[model samples]
Target: MTDRLPYWRLSGFYLFYFALLGATAPFFGLYFAHLGFSPERIGELLAIPMLMRCVAPNLWGWLGDVSGRRLAIVRFGALCTLLSFALIFVERSFAWLALVMALHAFFWHAVLPQFEVITLAHLREQAARYSQLRLWGSVGFILAVSGLGMLFERLGMQAWPWAIVAIMSGILLASLWVPNAQPEARSDRRARGGFIRQLRQPGVLAFFACVALMQLSHGPYYTFMSIHLEALGYGRGVIGLLWSLGVLAEILLFMVMSKVLARFSLRAILSASFVIAVVRWLLLGHLADELAILLLAQLMHAATFGAFHVASIHFIQRSFAAGQQGQGQALYATLSGIGGALGALYAGYSWTRLGPSWTFALASLAALVAAVIIATRLSEERA
Candidate 1:
């Protein structure tokens, strides 16, 4: 069955897409700090992409669904992302870099949700196989984070933007190789409810609410984990390995996701993820100075992000009809963006005043809240 799918091409796009994230997420804040930016400034700058994510995905997603041109949108967005990111080399001012971050992310943020729609369309009934393809993205992330960590240690941080540009080029190339896929046609009876109605269904809104909270809890980790490690005297190379270790755990979970899904209900998986996130953040906040404890926290990435994400995707696929797939995925990105932006902003403000321990404690509080909401509001059965 997998033989006929555009498996490699679709996976290639995910690989490069996440490779860019691997480069930026772990190192971008460090790069800003290298330029003597304050934690507040670094947080604001990093949040720009998440802010763009709040708007871009919905706009492009609507266009893709209405026009049946998802692949075209993906290709065009990739091109614009690469082009806008290149402007970083021309200026170093906070204002100029802010503009570049917003511009590039506006396009880069739009690409993935649309591509997710395309991939799901291609998957059709073989949806369980999604992790098989998506595991390669984890592979890409591990490569970029680990490789660049060592490279930066040797050559200095000046190489950061150049490495990103090179990877963004690969994203563009991968986008070109993926074929287009139209959403499967549905009977009038099946399509009658429309996007808004589906969203109003039981557990749907709560699921989205929890998603926002989950990403919000992730804000400090994504925004400052590397910086935190560096302050603790971990080298850039070791910090990168720590980051890769989390994603490596994620990849291992992805390998068995189908079996996991078969045995566990989505609600069970999601709730457990949130519960794990609470512990992960607390450990990160307080015990990070202890390497073994920190490693345990990183390994929990399997539940925090890996299982949670796969469950979210499955939930979205099951909740919406074929025609509404693009919007469903876009809303997921949008809510996540909203949560992520708020998280970064709060972490920035608190990192200095409240300090790392308190900031991550706040994150743990957010996850605890999400766990409560999901446990009660989410349906026991799959949507």
Candidate 2:
């Protein structure tokens, strides 16, 4: 195994991929609204891609494990995404959009989990620096969302799909260099017999439960934060700025995470994230109109999202070594994906009925529940 590629090159690739996320997530609701989609329609469309996350990634991981062709999966996913996005231009109906979303998503969602395995192989000794590498992804996201928001302010809403297409083009171009990044050899273990047996382990199950709750808690924010901000009289540009602020803090946190995790335990970081969320969500829910309070809360993205995310990845890496990485990464995706889908759905249901204040308050409570689960269940040693 080549243990010695410059970190930035690998990180740069991640930067481009995640930046694409930043572009899509914070503003897509606006695009749907501009197209005159009802809140339900917009939520359904926003969620269609995530639903694919639950199934597609696991399938791709299975194939990558069986064939040892991880990058091949990624390349195919990238191409499929290009094709899928192109389909959006064809008909502009709900059925067409949903089908396109699901089709591209089936291929798109599968790519990342396999590639995560590939990235860990490249990380070698500095696996903890994964965040530093991932943070550029945050940078890409900020640049994309904020820059494009300003452009949309000028160009109007119909240009939204074009912006998405352009970013997808960047991903396709980068995919050309990605195949060489695949792991030379992967863990021999495939998720076979007694996948439940593996899940039965107390510590491992505990970790999964915590992560699931964390994502579940994110349901409201992920589903409606931008929409809530928009309702509060913020323009698209400021909304993107708020989104960028959170991710920018996330990037800074990622830069220091390698060191931070070394000094602290995973439980410690995750627990702190939960505590911060208690305040963060309350602030967002109760005092959203107050800009200063909101900015402070946004900065907590460092702990709430950034630190917690790195810790989760490290937990997976530490728990599953070279031979079991495929299974480990798969499990991570399963929890975050399956668990996340449910969370988003719940958030979608809660957002309109409960309204933003109560919706986010409920999300905060979910984080608190997750914290208790983690604190009570996790051990000092890896489960």
Candidate 3:
């Protein structure tokens, strides 16, 4: 089964998908700033895409599940994303850019959740290997962040939109190479219950609540970290290296994740991730000027996003039936979007008033709450 897996094809899709993310996450806010937008405006513009995530994934997920056409959805979503993002070239006005962000993000967000379902379906009984495939996304992130960091430094930020369009074209091309897969049908009676019933299960709501909090805590980092680093006098190249260092750590963790999963309970991994997030945010908020401390905090991405994300995916696969996997993944994306939107909005409002330290302190508080929720409500055993 491992031998037959469309390893590179699947990996290629993830590579481009997250290459888009790598291009966007660390630099988009900076791009907004480059356009002379205020922090509040930048946050608002950035939040629009995240807010769309709250709506888009569940909608696309439902369409994929009902149609059993996950790959078609992925391809169409990719096409729409590319077309919509190209609108960025038309206008740089606040109103037009806002519309562009919302449009591109609506379709862009649609691609990943459905594609995740597709990837897992392809993995079948070898689902534990998910991290290996997903690690390529981190690789893509490293390349984009590190390479483009230098590119932008040389060419100036005007090139950002063009670079993203080119990468998104790659995403569309990659989607064409991968074969579609459906979740294997199950005979287990538990699957007979509807999706809502699955949601009401013990620890399920709590798990989702934590998901929102985790992503919410990330709001400041994603929305302003580049700007924040720039304020601290870091060069674009160093900033890119710092961002890539986090994903590089994530890649290393993915390489060893199967063994880690075997040794630790999902609950434990999740709780520790939240705890690390609490620490990581504080370090970023208070100590970012210290390169050594910043590096340590960046390494914690291995746990905050890397381990935590893998654990959450496994939890969903276990908690939901095969028939419900699309919606399950959709709901995960939806919650993440909700948390991220709120996080961005709040970070936007707070950043100018309370300053970066306090902004990240609020993020730490969110992670602390998540750690507590997971500790008390999540199952000690694997879901």
After superposition, the stretches of candidate 1 with alpha carbons farther than 4 Å from their true spots are 188-190
Compute the lDDT of residue 205 as modeled in candidate 1: 99
* Backbone Cα, N, C clashes tallied per candidate: 0, 1, 0
Candidate order (TM-score): 3, 1, 2
Candidate 2 minimal-lDDT segment of 10 residues:
185-194
Candidate 3 lDDT over residue span 285-377, tens digit each: 999999999999999999999999999999999998888888999999999999999999999999999999999999999999999999999
Query: Which number leads on lDDT?
Result: 3
Clashing pairs in 1: none
lDDT of 1 by residue, 214-295 (tens): 9999999999999999999999999999999999999999999999999999999999999999999999999999999999
User: Which segments of model 2 are wrong by more than 4 Å?
Assistant: 1-3, 179-197
List the global CA lDDT of all models.
Answer: 0.93, 0.77, 0.94
What's the C-alpha lDDT at position 375 in model 3? 96
- Scanning candidate 1 in windows of ten residues, the lowest lDDT window is 183-192
TM-score of each: 0.98, 0.92, 0.99
